[model samples]
Target: MERDFDTTKDVVTNEVKAKKSAQAKADAQLWVVASGKGGVGKTFVTTSLGLTLSKLGHSVVIVDLDLSGANVHTSLGANPSHMNIRHYFEGAKSLQELVIPTTYPRLSYVQGFWDSWTPTDFSYNQIQNLIPELKKLRADYVLVDLGAGALEAHLNLFKTADEKILVTSPEPTSIEKTYRFIEAYMCHSLKENAAPDAFGNMITTLRDHRQRTLSKPFSFKSYLKEQTGISYTFFEALSQKPVRLVVNSCRSQANAELGHSIKSVCHKYYDLGIDFTASINYDNAVWQSVKSRTPALVAQPFTPLAGQFLNSCKHLIDPEELRAVV
Candidate 1:
């Protein structure tokens, strides 16, 4: 049976290669999927969305960028390829060479390193160099599953994406951490784009102040008002970056409504516009599929959870307005 499966995969892979060569260079839309905390279903969402996009006739590459704890390959019921991101980082392979064809024809993956092989520290220059190479891949869409937490590396990677998807559950702790992630990203953006010296001083001052006054929320708008020159207008214009939010493991209607509540709070406090795109119900099928090493959609295409994921993809593709389908 294993031999038969290999033969089928090889045939499909060859067919895809032929199709790829016959086509013109793909202008892919890059998406970065991230979360504030670990085990929030970020990888599950990424894989399901990539599969759904491919099923819609778009070629998609899901790159597992969660270097420290990479396991996106396991979710696809596949082992790590010999050529992965680690090889690319070590100069043994080009970014293009790292892409391995999956059993699904339109979906490919750039596998990630295992825990033992994960790098302790990846420099900013390395990440900056990776961005252009990723953009050069020929696919309709590229989904990068980022590591959880708001580390500088993670936030920088999130910023590089054309569109960013932040995943979180209804738990209070998860929501709090998600807000912190957003705060960190906003600070990172300001420091990079605005007056570096002034913003740096301001960030330091704010950090000290926050340590003293733990209950107060940091206000970007208020901070910008006090600043002079480019920093002021740059932050004002930062509102243009839209982040889509997905609420996962929702058990009830109230839990689902947390998406909207978070959006409202962000708009009021952070002056950041967040779109509450989709809420996924707490379904046992999701875990079952994961345990079986199959994507939920592929394992049970007609299930409600699968339908919800598809709807979320449609809304993501055409996000002129929010379509909350829980």
Candidate 2:
């Protein structure tokens, strides 16, 4: 059975290779969009961002890996279909076979499961395999919607991407959850990449600092520098993959600036610098587009929501752009 599976994968690889254009050979950049909790507009952001990119004449694919909430298709006005990731896992189709085009030109997506058991048990090994297949797609960008939470499985996908965009609202609960998610992600990355001794020391120091100064926030960077004084490689590696943050549902200038505040907290406490890429205002057009089952960029291209998505994509595509809290 293992041999048969390997043979099948090889065949799919060759078939995909044959179908690729010169542009596809360059490989698509994987942009993973996730949230610390649900109802933070993660899927909406994914669809809108992809739509904006497509308008720029870049081919984009949005994969609804958020199996539990799998509504990327609905948000993009694509009807339900059996062409989903579950079929790929069942060996019934290749990832390439599952690509379904959206109504918007240059945009496409893979439907996720609905009214069925979510692939919550999707293991790390499976993600490693899945990413290579995603890269084989003939697109300039592949936006993966990872739904929510800080589960180890989710963090693995989040950290493995070429770019990571974390979506959150300005609500207090959302802000708290986002921080917890980042902490979980940091711990996960440390465990995976740090030496056993170094990992143990840092973790212990973090816990001790929290206990001693319950009122004061713990900064892993300070402890690592003062005590461990031995290894800076892990943090240096983390610095290279700074997560991009997007604050959604902002109703005021203060709400929009929440992203900047979160960015400051992350840099100070976690020693991680995250880009405050966008702050989407609370606009009726956004939810209206959701009700119409069309992306805001497509349904109301002239709306402020569309403009915000455009800015988000610009910052994502070109990190050198001066970021401002919109």
Candidate 3:
């Protein structure tokens, strides 16, 4: 694998930096891949998709944003001790300087910090600094691999993506956690955008409703629609932010339909329409490739898993097929 960081390209002029930043933001697409819980092939999907895009002649950069877990480099067959995001976090290097070329043509990645010393939670200033740098990365597609769960940092990072893909397994626990993630993200977005006084009362009502029955399905849409104080732009933003769902490790047709079921639930209760992009079946080649520290698409290019990754990339790259909430 080509794990070299190009340090020869230095001493860039201010005008060149400004022009490059503008060009990158104008051309590149940022895709954030996340999961409700770990153990669901989120990083695998990210690396596979990045390889697929690269094979199609697009410059792809896979960023391991899952700082605490930080294993994208391992999956891509790169040394973990090589220059990573820790250098950027510790002020030893800029974010752009951390980008390292992968073995595949047109593919590169920014490794995450796996050391315990790296902060698990970021402050507001850190997020502000990191996001712009991420947007400025020069690539056709920038794939960010987020850690599992609905942590504030994850949701904040997720909200800024040009494309958001929520990966999940078909198991009952995974499906439930996926729903909880969507709910948490919805509430997080509202907390950030909605009027504080109005949202405060809304939260109290939500808490009261939760106390009625553990089986009661949560519905934030109906309650929010009833409120007259909140601005329409809040609802518009919620309606417009489309999430693409990918169900991984499927064993049967029923397992494949889980993505659709989750999408239906989100539209019903959360007022968000999520695309059921692709369902990848259980394949031993996937694990075998990972065990060898290589992406499945690159190691087993002729396998069924590679075909599925190609299909998923096609669905993801097309902008018109994305469904917005009604």
Top candidate by lDDT = 2
Judged by lDDT relative to the true structure, which candidate is superior, 1 or 3? 1
* RMSD to truth, every model: 9.8, 9.7, 9.3
Judging by TM-score, tell me the better candidate of 2 and 3: 2
Off by over 4 Å in 1: 1-23, 115-119, 204-219, 229-239, 318-326
Q: Give the residue spans of candidate 3 off by over 4 A.
A: 1-27, 117-119, 208-219, 319-326
Clash tally, candidates in order: 0, 0, 0
Candidate 1, residues 226-314: lDDT per residue as tens digits? 76643555445545557889999999999989999999988776667778889998888888987898888888888888888888888
Summarize candidate 2's per-residue lDDT along 80-169 as a digit string, tens digits: 886788888778999989999977788999998764753455877888889889888888889999968997778888888989899999
**lDDT computed for candidate 1:** 0.81
| Model 3 per-residue lDDT tens digits across residues 1-326 | 23333333333455689887776557468899999999999998898888888877678899998865888888898887668887887799997898999877889999887666735676667777888788778788889999899988888888888888999999888888888888777778777657888888877776665566435565666667777665535557645657788999999989988888888877776567778889998888778876888767777788787888878877777645333311
Top-down lDDT ranking: 2, 1, 3
Q: TM-scores across all candidates?
A: 0.83, 0.85, 0.84
Scored against the true structure, residue 287 in model 2 reaches a CA lDDT of 80
- Clashes in candidate 3: how many? 0
Worst lDDT 10-window in candidate 3? 1-10
